[model samples]
Target: MQSSVEAIFAPQPAPEGYAEHIGTGLTLRRSASRANAQQVHQLRPHVVEMAAQYDRLTMPVEIIHGDADTIVPMHIHAEELIKDIPNGALTRLPGMGHMPQHTAPQAVVDAIDRAAARAGLR
Candidate 1:
């Protein structure tokens, strides 16, 4: 029996398979999907309500912001999120654009290690 699916609609191969287990470096250009602003607009209310509920107002958190980020605008979201978080420390990385995981993998790893240590995740 012939399937109804067309050849063009077949699933594409995953470039990096689970067996590879590549290092935690990011590939945002290939990974990130640019969504329409309108799509995000519809979810704003739900997002804000969720944020208010899980603000982490009493937890010790470290926030690192890329000053040159255009996707997640430092002046808008990250800064405000940091402000709302109690005992939050913000690290502003100058000349670092969006997607620090790709541009500064070491820094991201270091931050995670530090956070883990602080949280006693040894």
Candidate 2:
């Protein structure tokens, strides 16, 4: 069973037999380099502090989130974001997971259109 954190961040399963293809020397080196890249954990506090001031934003904010997203739960991220921002709106897509931009591009575009329209930018 996946831990709650893993479930939330990596809800989708890797493609079958993907591990078997990672043995190439180039792949291993690339993977290792990426793993060693800069860590952003130290910035969590700063990010949270900035997010807390959402209501101060004057521009329209649109949150496009999948209802089935597990990595960042809709309630904890999208819903709360909408509630916190003065001009925020949420476009909740049912049966979609976290990567809505990849999984449902048209919906994401529609959400963008809606946001633009709401902001009178269309």
Candidate 3:
């Protein structure tokens, strides 16, 4: 858990205009504080348990993930998740990153629409 926290807070070069868009300086201060690690540790078990039950989900599941995401690699996270879910559908956005809603809003909306249609909610 300590290693996980360290990786998350590990310094990386800022992407272009990142600070400008968020209107603040990117700092590793919060990561160094280790407050988030405790919260994650508490929630990790619950998250793992829920993930294990993905095969039992009856509702439509729409998974939209960026193919270019390094933080949560497509194969390791979304791809693996879809394999476990009976009704899971993955929408892989080419050349996109972790934040698909911000990077590919239309694709995200379309995926949501498809999920709703599958669930008869739209």
By lDDT, the best candidate is: 3
Estimate, for each residue in 45-101, the C-alpha lDDT of model 1 and write its tens digit: 887886886456655577777787655678897788876776667778777766566
Q: Which stretches in model 2 have alpha-carbon errors above 4 Å?
A: 1-38
lDDT of 2 by residue, 35-94 (tens): 645345456788799998888998878789888887778898788788889988788888
lDDT of 1: 0.60
**Cα-based RMSD of the predictions, in order?**
11.3, 5.4, 5.9
Candidates sorted by lDDT, descending order?
Answer: 3, 2, 1
How well does model 3 score by local distance difference test?
Answer: 0.74
Poorest 10 consecutive residues by lDDT, candidate 2 = 1-10
Residue-level error in angstroms, candidate 1, position 66: 1.0
Per-residue alpha-carbon lDDT of candidate 3 for residues 2-93, written as tens digits (9 for 90 to 100)? 33333332333344555466544333467644766777679979989998888999999999987777778889989899999999899888
Measured against the true structure, the TM-scores of the candidates, in listed sequence, are 0.60, 0.68, 0.73
Clashing pairs in 2: 8-70, 8-71, 9-71
